[model samples]
Target: MSVLKPKIMMLIGCLMTSSAMATEVEPYNKANAQQLKQSIYERTATATSAIERYQLAKSEAWLSYADHEYSEGGFTSAGKEAYIQANQLLEPSNVNLVTQIISPSQVMRRDLWWQIEYLKQRGALDVEPQALANAEVMLVWAAAEYCELGWRHAREHFISAERELQKVIYALPEEKPFLNWSETETPELSALNGKGCHGVNPDLWPLKPKTPVEPEVIDADVANVVVENVVHFAVDRAVLNTEGKRVLEQIANILAEYPDMNITLKGYTDIRASVAYNIALSQRRIDSVRDYLLEKGVNSSRITAEAKGKLEPQDDQKIEMAHAKSRRVVVYFNDAETNSITVQPQWRDLQIER
Candidate 1:
């Protein structure tokens, strides 16, 4: 009977209504392929983020496969390859790579649902709001894919999509109530804003504050300095966390002290997802590190960033420790004196297990 209870109930009602509306869409038709492809390509071309680009690529590949299946009667070998390529950009497992054809339409829908769920589990909802929007779009696309397969597939997809959408909607932050409100907010309603409500936990949103680290000094007289302080990142995150920022702060101070020294940040990732995704993720991480250095007053000309992705994992074993070690960015430093004195760069020929 509390005032906030009514507000919470109203919000839930509205979300349920939206979910219902989402399920009432018409059946997908083959003739929409060209239009869908064009739309997807346009989005890809203008996408500012890696996730957005990958989402568009997935949509393009799905539509292309659908077009081939409906118009040409079943998937052509070439078309299947294209599908695999597109799938590889987001996740690069060998099992997904070696598949000869696209997954069953319903299975694909389920896979999309799981991928979105994975993102939500990993705290992407708070860190990357666009991912939530992309997930919703993907669900709608999955529903359409099911529509093409027939009534039963469509029904299953619709139900799945509705469930997923409801979760996302409930996860979104609620608006603050007016200060002058006559009624008191219940403890449950207040807790929703802080710790989340209706199965959503705001504390788990992955946006933790980063602690600062003291900067390290690099010896200018050294022939080559490779700081073993590798910056680690969470899965699919380009933004630096507190620990990462601290490491970069140290690197920035080193760069500031040795104005003539140049640094390269080589980014690498664990073998969890696709090569393309890892590569892109690595680049973003390095870029973030480099940008932090620049912000800390390092010359842009003295810094460079490179991405090796999953091709150069620190540990190739399929273990948590291996994956943790692999998701890192290493700093390599060289001064004019050091570069001239050394016959060969230390890490140039270093072999890393993929």
Candidate 2:
């Protein structure tokens, strides 16, 4: 069977063109190209050592290949050959540039996997376990892309990424930063794992599934209690400020009074960023609130947190005030008459006594 069917190759061609079009513009194209060219030449001229020269050469090779691919409107055999030549110049010392500038989509070949292993063997990525893990995840994604294209080496890339991820997981400490492994559900992961890649080892996975916590029923009298406080967050942050903590304290006190009443924290964000980023940020905001409440003696089961992301904006206007109003966490008790309270424009505009 062909690695990539004609239709799949056509779709990839469309995507590559679209990506270039999205970033290119009439006024900037010529200037950007000239600037890149100048930078490359300057870097090459300033190279004082063999390593520096090799790095510069590799960069030039990649840039040349990228230009060709963009101009030609798709990946070509010449581009792949240039990439392979560039790969020979890569060493552990160049890992920083490789990680920062090279993306999986740009180097979707066995050579990419070779470079990854070369860096690992040299212990250059020892301090960057998290980054290595992320690269592995991207490799898995790239493998899936290759599989769709019907590339013969798709399974090889998947197995390589899986092994690299496993190594990183083994070296990591018990406590680590949040790594979204939800992409493991991709058909590629399942397909590759079924072939004995073992990419879905839960023991090494950082994020274990949490048991669903149900909200408690609110008492008839407690249902009359007003629940309209909006907890604010700093721009692009999930850490609660002094004012946010104070607001949560008030909510905690109320929850203390009504033991049977449950509170739902719905998080939101302004639409300034991508949908995926905003959604993640919104979830982090509510998680910050839920954690603070838990610390203040609020029952975990009685509080439920949900992320509405940019979907539920209090005001649709793109002004600063509207943006501030949109980036908030709204509190609602399970049975409280909460619908009447109007969402204020900003944290400062709230009627709450500071």
Candidate 3:
């Protein structure tokens, strides 16, 4: 056999005799194992460009051995060490790949613990194991939930991001309160570094949406549909002063302008006397206006006379003037069959109760 062949054989023989290393190897002892270990070492060395490359190649061999141990149904402590060593060799340069692999799983999805563990594995953190792991975990969770928004509810992502960012900001060292990051780094991993977790886009979360204004509804069919305020009051007391007459004239003009418009004359009074007395007073007030309008040439059917006793008022006019606001007539134009009345009374001659 060649000189190198004998050395390879001797090294493999020694490796196989770990349980009894002091005992001299016989010629036939673990001949296959001796050949395999030597071949593994030789192939690793051949793949290398330099010592560093050799180290990486050795790491791969260690990984293969660990895989073999796992496949054999029992892993030794030494096998775990080999696996860890292999991972360490690959971690720093392969962060993005590792993140991609672990990010999608439910347990590791944007989870801080998993992120911290990953960073620790890559030797990015030098703190106590627990602290480093916990801190990274929070940042990972925040980035996953808030950055680009993965497969989770928006609200849940927002809440989780808030909590995680708060922890990361507060726990960071005073001198290095910000995380080290770069654009070319793992996009998902780098996205977690502090900025506005929720500030990706503002127009997306609009402060206020544009709204359309509705046009004011006016019934052209009603002749007395005056935009100006009109008020009415009890009989004898229902007499319109100069200002009241001006308002009344506006109503009349509105009716004249729209020939098809009809009017409903409603009268009301406060609870001054008995209900019956108030009811009569309201009817009288409405009649007085109807007579005046009739004399003014308005058709009797065009105006519907109705009375409301001591119920509706314009103002709580306890004195004569304020009472005048309460005791008044209201003209509803478009309410012919079905329409909601939205106009408020600004003028009236109705009784105001204390």
**Against the hidden reference, what TM-scores do the models get?**
0.32, 0.33, 0.31
Order the candidates by TM-score, highest first.
2, 1, 3
**Candidate 3 per-residue C-alpha lDDT over 93-177 given as tens digits, one digit per residue, 9 for 90 to 100:** 3212111111211222333333332333232222222233223323333343433355463345334433333333323222122
Model-by-model lDDT, in order? 0.48, 0.50, 0.43
- Candidate 2 pairs with clashing backbones: 3-149, 3-150, 3-151, 4-149, 4-150
**Residue 196 in candidate 1, Cα distance off native in Å:** 44
Residue 268 CA error for candidate 2 (Å)?
0.5
Find the candidate with the highest TM-score and give its number.
2
User: Which regions of candidate 2 deviate over 4 angstroms?
Assistant: 1-227, 316-318, 336-346, 349-354
Q: State the lDDT of candidate 2 residue by residue for 1-354, as single tens digits.
A: 012234422322232221232322222233554565676577657756433543554445454554554476665543443343233333333322232212233333333334444333333233333335345435644444463454564665555454444334323322111132233332333332343322232222222222223246578664554443777665687777776687788789877877877888899987688888998999999999999999999989998878888887655222544565677888877855334222222243221111
Total clashing pairs in model 1: 4
lDDT of 1 by residue, 113-229 (tens): 333443433333343334344344444444345535555755754554444443343233221111122223122323422321122223322112222232365678863644334
The candidate that wins on lDDT is 2
Model 2 poorest ten-residue lDDT run: 345-354
Q: Stretches of candidate 3 above 4 Å error? A: 1-226, 234-236, 313-322, 335-344, 348-354
